[model samples]
Target: MTLGSRLTALPAVMMTPVAALMLATLVVLAPGLALACEDLTNRTQTAYKAGDLATLKDTFAAAEANADCSAETLQWMGKAIVSTVLRSVHEDVSQGGSLQAHETALREARPYGQDWRLEAWLGDIAFERGDFTEAATAFQDALNTLNDEELTPTAPDTAVIEEVYNKAEMARLAAADYVSAPTTRSGEPGGLAAPSYRGFQPAARLVPVEFQFGSTLVTPKGLRALRDLRDALRASGTQSITLVGHTDPVGGMAANDRLSLARAESVAASLRNEGYTGQIYVVGRGERDPLQWVAPLTQHQYHQALRRVEVRQ
Candidate 1:
């Protein structure tokens, strides 16, 4: 089944609304690391594809132990474990999976030096959970990690190197936009700035649709939110729509800036798929603006509040 179909098919006990959607967006957080270690990678991929968390946990533990054969192998294994566990805990019976496992693997990988992948995944988690502040923070940390020349270099393949650069750029752009979400301030009505950057009321208050990490694909809740938005728009005499996409501060800012635009494009694609023909316009804001301002609060609340796309009439 497709990612969306799989998510919808899962029982609530297997996956909560937030975790299900959040994980779905980050299916490729590790990118091509799997290609480097096909044998170990296959076991993990098979378990995930089958939705067998039991097999997944054991397989990961085995891979974690056996895969320390090389520098890249060790780093990739830890990265994949943390990346997958963040999703698996919200899936079918953990059997043996837990966040503790992720930490354990990370502690083991400390000998390999920090990598951008770990920070990137954490940012993605925060972003998916609706926490923009943390997402931005993590993304920034990932970028800083990338600055270290000592990190194991990619293999001699030019294509892989280019892909790495692109992903990094994407993360940077994404982080740039994500940071804005926390710092943005609105201009008061009857003053110099626009009345409200938050967009039209009622619609703004209810954003039912939540996207998957690094993707514009909406979750089941996001779909329902869109349905409600469609009806609301029709009623409001909205001649056309402007989809503004935002990114949690993760990955490369350039990439995520495009990601913000991609989100708008993705929504527009969904509209088209649904046969929406009105003047559907998309604006990729690239995380330059945020609907909510950052303040001292729980990380979860910060995550849930940022990492969203807003609709304008």
Candidate 2:
């Protein structure tokens, strides 16, 4: 059916007064412009159905430039554009594309008014980049919005809300730790890696060092604690220290393994910079050894506790 006939066939409830006013304005502007808008909208619908992101992007932009398009038509085009961009971002992440590379695309979709989804994507980008403070703020903004279903229609509403909430809480904890306390030294059960060594104790004592999620750098407070350890080891004449790195079970096993080991290496480097001459052994167990293992639903709550480097002397 032609676009005009389809419009006329739509139920009255489907046509808002704003949409009707837009149609009247389109008619007054120029019949040819209205026809052009209809043609562009048709092309957009076809591209969206075919999952032709390139064509959908082109047609959406064309429609946006033409005021002859009805409000309803533009709204549909906006949804299509945002959906296409979101799918592309997911694809990029699956293929190991840098998160920063697709951040601009998500930001560009902001004009489409899917604030919840756009903010959620921005939060993910910040989280992956190790900017926990920004991530927490973005996730909080997403939580304040009420239309996550508009973006992730396939996922269960409760699951989506829970996931976003967990991420936000995790980010908030990491951000808070970064600002106030960088070193966590306690006999906390979930904090220990429980290395294989049997009762291996040295004269010097070292504790597990907490790290920000997806990060490998030693924090300033952690550096200070390591300096103290270095001085104690020197006094005790300790010959070697074991550093075991760990992460929460959030990402793929292989990636988590690499990240865990990277965290240990970062600590070792910091110790070396502090002039600790003792031998250093580093191990990356990844998520294989969690001080406390919880279900995926509650994993984020323990993420900060899990992402740590154990210093055994």
Candidate 3:
């Protein structure tokens, strides 16, 4: 029988909307398992970005419940996880968390296949992490995958081909033979790499935290932000934090310096209480390095911006 004949012979009960599109070439048509898996591809990326592990767990279960552990699901699942991990690594490096976050993602998704976008990201991650050879190889693999008619559903456009070629050539400049890099520590448990660092612009304020004026107290809102920052830093294997405090040009300039140091110490104490054993370095730049240079029209705006400790991981 011809390809059309086989599709036509499929029972009505087994027909999905996807299966009906005979002329289309997407390999996403099947029963309950395949459908859930299809939905999972996007949902997993969303949940990872939101820092909602609970939601990720739910999505994983929904996709797996009806899944037959097929090759397609495995490939897409690996792709989703790779995306999550790449986001984490970049976010870490950008946020001063740690650049090492890319290792497990690279090791985990490599077995899936020569997925173009995934390999492209893998190349960038390796390049940024100083693994030039892997970067070259992965980018080359991406270019090859994009060129392969059998592997890709459609040939990549000229623009895409040019972009991939540019990235690959850049990698080749620094490329050389090197040993395969190790994955994350063998004893470390595998879990979602976090904070969905895609389009992640760290808040303009100091570590997205705020402090009460004159007192060493952190506001409730500040506490929540600090906890999130602390967790991500620790999870990234960061071993130390530096807290730099600043104060508005209020009261005696000298006195403000003392107060600022006190505030930094207060925040440091809170992190210690939370079981962060790493060294906490505190510095006070009272009215010295004002974030708001122009005298604010109002006192509230001036003090609010200055009265905080910035976190450096």
Candidate 4:
């Protein structure tokens, strides 16, 4: 069955409202390295054509373990593995195939190749299991990949793309709301924060803070999302919070640096308004730091993920 068909076919209990539509829009949407892996090409190609998900999974895992597979070969195997997963998402997740297991498989396959389709599936499964934070990130990852292609004049599925974008954005907001949900209500601290610049010291964490495009104005919705972060500070007795600003590689370096810093300042201001009395530290990395960097910058979605303020807590 197609991805959309598979989604709709899922039991009501397993599918989210956004899950159905989010995957439906993806209807229109690899090689490896190894010499001892000479047989790798034939085996992966055969499994892909035959829709053998089990074999694809085994082959990918083995290939990865062998340490001899070329990037091209592993990437091909990764695509095949993803295809099998999509073809069998429902069965895999419903029949003793835990969401975590499938998610783990996809995560392993991701470095081999990253694309809109894989990320969309990742988002779909995450949403299925109520991991909205992960769902939001995966969906945004897919949207950014899609948007990167949209920069081309001949981009197809423009309408379908927008539908997907709306749903993805909605998922993200839902995630933010979940994060903002009181600890008393959520029964836990916020889900793992959005990814931050890797090279940042003391590790990078993010609040659900968002800013308007090309402007430092924090959205009203974004302002509301800071409650969880504020509460976390209170709970931890953390005396200070650090805010690091980052931007997508859309504009000049100097301009992005300034914009990123400005964006962080905006969030800092919002935090104070939200009753965060701690010493707030702010700095901007500009385009120097991105959560995920895709080339050509035409891929606005990837850039979108990069453009944000992160909290070092």
lDDT by residue for model 3 (1-313), tens: 2223322322221122112222233233334445435666566556655645456556655666754456666555544444454444444544444333555655665664445655765665676655666776777666555545555555544555554455454444333322121122332211111221122222221443456777777766567656755665676676877888777787888898998898888888888898888888998888788652221124574466567777665
What TM-score fits each model?
A: 0.34, 0.41, 0.37, 0.42
Q: Residue 35 lDDT in model 1?
A: 52
The top-ranked prediction according to lDDT is 2
lDDT (tens digit, per residue) of candidate 1 on 60-151: 56655664335555454444444354444433223433333354444343343354455544544454444554555555444444433344
lDDT of 4 by residue, 227-250 (tens): 656766666667787899887677
Model 4: how far is 201 from its true place, Å? 13
lDDT over C-alpha atoms for residue 140 of model 3: 61
What ranges in model 1 sit over 4 Å off?
1-208, 294-297
Candidate 1 clashes: the total is 22
Q: How many angstroms is residue 306 displaced in model 3 relative to the true structure, after the best TM-score fit?
A: 1.5
lDDT of each residue in 110-217, candidate 2, tens digit only: 776554556766876777656776776677566544223343333324445455555664565455343211211232111111121122222322243667678886
Cα RMSD (angstroms) for every candidate in the order listed: 19.0, 18.9, 20.0, 16.3
Ranking by TM-score: 4, 2, 3, 1
List the candidates ranked by lDDT, beginning with the highest.
Answer: 2, 4, 3, 1
Clash count, one per candidate: 22, 0, 0, 14
What local lDDT score does residue 116 receive in model 2, on the 0 to 100 scale?
54
Query: Which 10 successive residues of model 2 have the least lDDT summed?
Result: 188-197
Clashing residue pairs for model 2: none
Backbone clashes, candidate 2: 0
